[model samples]
Target: MPLKSIRVLDLTRLLPGPYCTMLLADFGAEVIKVEDPMMGDYARAYEPKTDEKSAFFHSLNRNKKSICLNLKSHEEKQYFLRLVEEADIVVESFRPGVMEKLGLDYQILRDINPGLIYCSITGFGQTGPYKDKPGHDINYISYAGLLNLMGERDGKPVVPAAQIADIGGGALPAAIGILLALIERGKSGRGQFVDISMLDGVLSWLQILLPGYLTNHIEPERGKQTLSGGLACYEVYQTKDDRWLSVGALEPKFWSNFCKTIGKEEFIPKLGEPIDQQDVMKYEIQKVIRRKTLKDWLEAFADKDACVSPVHTLHEVIASPQVSARQMLQNIPQQTNSLQQPGIPIKLSETPGKIRSQAPEHGEHTKQILSQFGVKEK
Candidate 1:
């Protein structure tokens, strides 16, 4: 595996940093989750537990080992420094100065280990007006202007079901930054700080929309943009069974194919007409789609070149044929019985990511890891 020889000391307890380290662990990196001896990860107490263990925690912390320690203690601080000396990467999601307050900031860690790739995942980043402000996934997206752009036309913006700010904005960017820093380390023989802000990450996702807003000096509103449901050819329509189907026939060819397939050739030229005309066409398309069941529409478009697809529920998506074929779900070996969990997303011809083990219990390997790292417990 690519990261088999790499060692990551994960100091994150919740979503963003844990998720970042989880990706590394899946790719065969040695990820040691360092948690507080008292509570461990707060996710362990998250609701919807199985046999008293948090399912949420299990989902994020798989393929990693756990060790407990008090960072404020003098002895434990020295022990952590020793571990840092051997670590290739260190990830933390604390506020701006939390690590510095604990005497474990990058500056001090670099003195002990020059080749340390230190990654800091925060809401606003290490230096910003809101650096010390606390926030979660929703808050980050709200601040980044992403939340305001997510709902219906003229309706109040809806909270996203997915934690895009957490996973997309923070975790994925942190992983990418760490990988880039590691590559740079190979050439420079020195490590660097990787600052990943949820706000910055979310803003980066607005590449398409931001340019338009900046260039035209027009503030893009919710559901008013082409990709945001302003077009008749690129929106969701409800089927007769009340299930939804997404129609994304945005291109000319796809729109033509869809219009012909649905026996609505008159609507072809109205694909991207003015907003009022598009709304009229959208209503007509919705009425047509409502005459058929979701299953019927799926079958009708099965052989068509139109970009139409069913909007599946979570359960339906889990059992989908494409998802099964892609191996997006895997059986994780837990202490009791094997449990099905989300599989690694990135597919590599060589050195592919794998789920080596289930999430570790709190402080499950503290003594063993200490022994392996040559730190004698006194």
Candidate 2:
């Protein structure tokens, strides 16, 4: 209940913006999701529908109210300005100029209320050579050098299954920036603009790698670096049953312990060797791991010194004992009297985020929101 009375105008449609607002909403903010009057958020049409509503939409947009409006209309724009007068935050995920063209940019809103925390989520940024170029999560990751470091050494670059750039880089960082700006506003009595670029976020995530490249003159390649897939101590190997095991015994002591436990004690001395020598050690370790079933190997390292763990599939991940113990997953109840959705991630002793309501139907709160501004319902 930390943000019990704070209001956030969510003008973002897809993942990044919606996900960020969801975080704010979880912490007891009154988030009003403003969608297009006709199409609404495109996410509403995403697949795996239960009853003309998307499971994807429901998961990301819970604990928020929806108000559909035609921003192009002058009357609606005036009504939005009135909402801005009472709002603490206004988040939008459009290209740099789109909002400005619509006259809803930070400058205009700040003129009305100087304490508005306006966050703009984009691909490249507001100003840059590629700022205007259209990009999705994959393109942003590729531009940020993250995708270049993924995949097998000799194989094609593999795009990660998760939208790391979109969710991690853009959404989470934007949310953190908004919170920080809000904290700063307590003293300054003013708001500021937050420009969250997916490419910038991913590059920030590569802090160690970038510094190493710049200082040591080491041009790290895909699957050829220690943290990537090059090191024998840190790599994934397939077992006899086609299951995979992730080995992360990167520390010298852990590597020594792992080499000894796998019955390849002789390879302990070669742990710090070059790639060719490391490959010899890796081959022997792979052979040992391949000899056993994933389950057997899992038990063998259950309480051992080896930093070994079985790579779990999505189904296995949901049912994992660790996940259950952490209470990371919660079942959100549906407003349509259907099944529950997944719960919020972070846990807080005070002001924890909660799902107050299911994602609203398109424009479900439009009439109510308009009435708040003294506009008569159509």
Worst 10 residues of 2 by lDDT: 332-341
lDDT string, candidate 2, 70-184, tens digits: 8899888888898999999999999889998999999999999999999999998898899899989999989888888999889989989999988999999999999999999
Best by lDDT: 1
Q: Candidate 1 on 208-282: residue-level lDDT in tens?
A: 798898899999878878999899899999999999999899999999999998889998888769888988898
Q: How many residue pairs clash in each candidate at the backbone level?
A: 0, 2
Runs with alpha carbons beyond 4 Å of true place in candidate 1: none
Measured on C-alpha atoms, candidate 1 has an lDDT of 0.92
lDDT of each: 0.92, 0.87
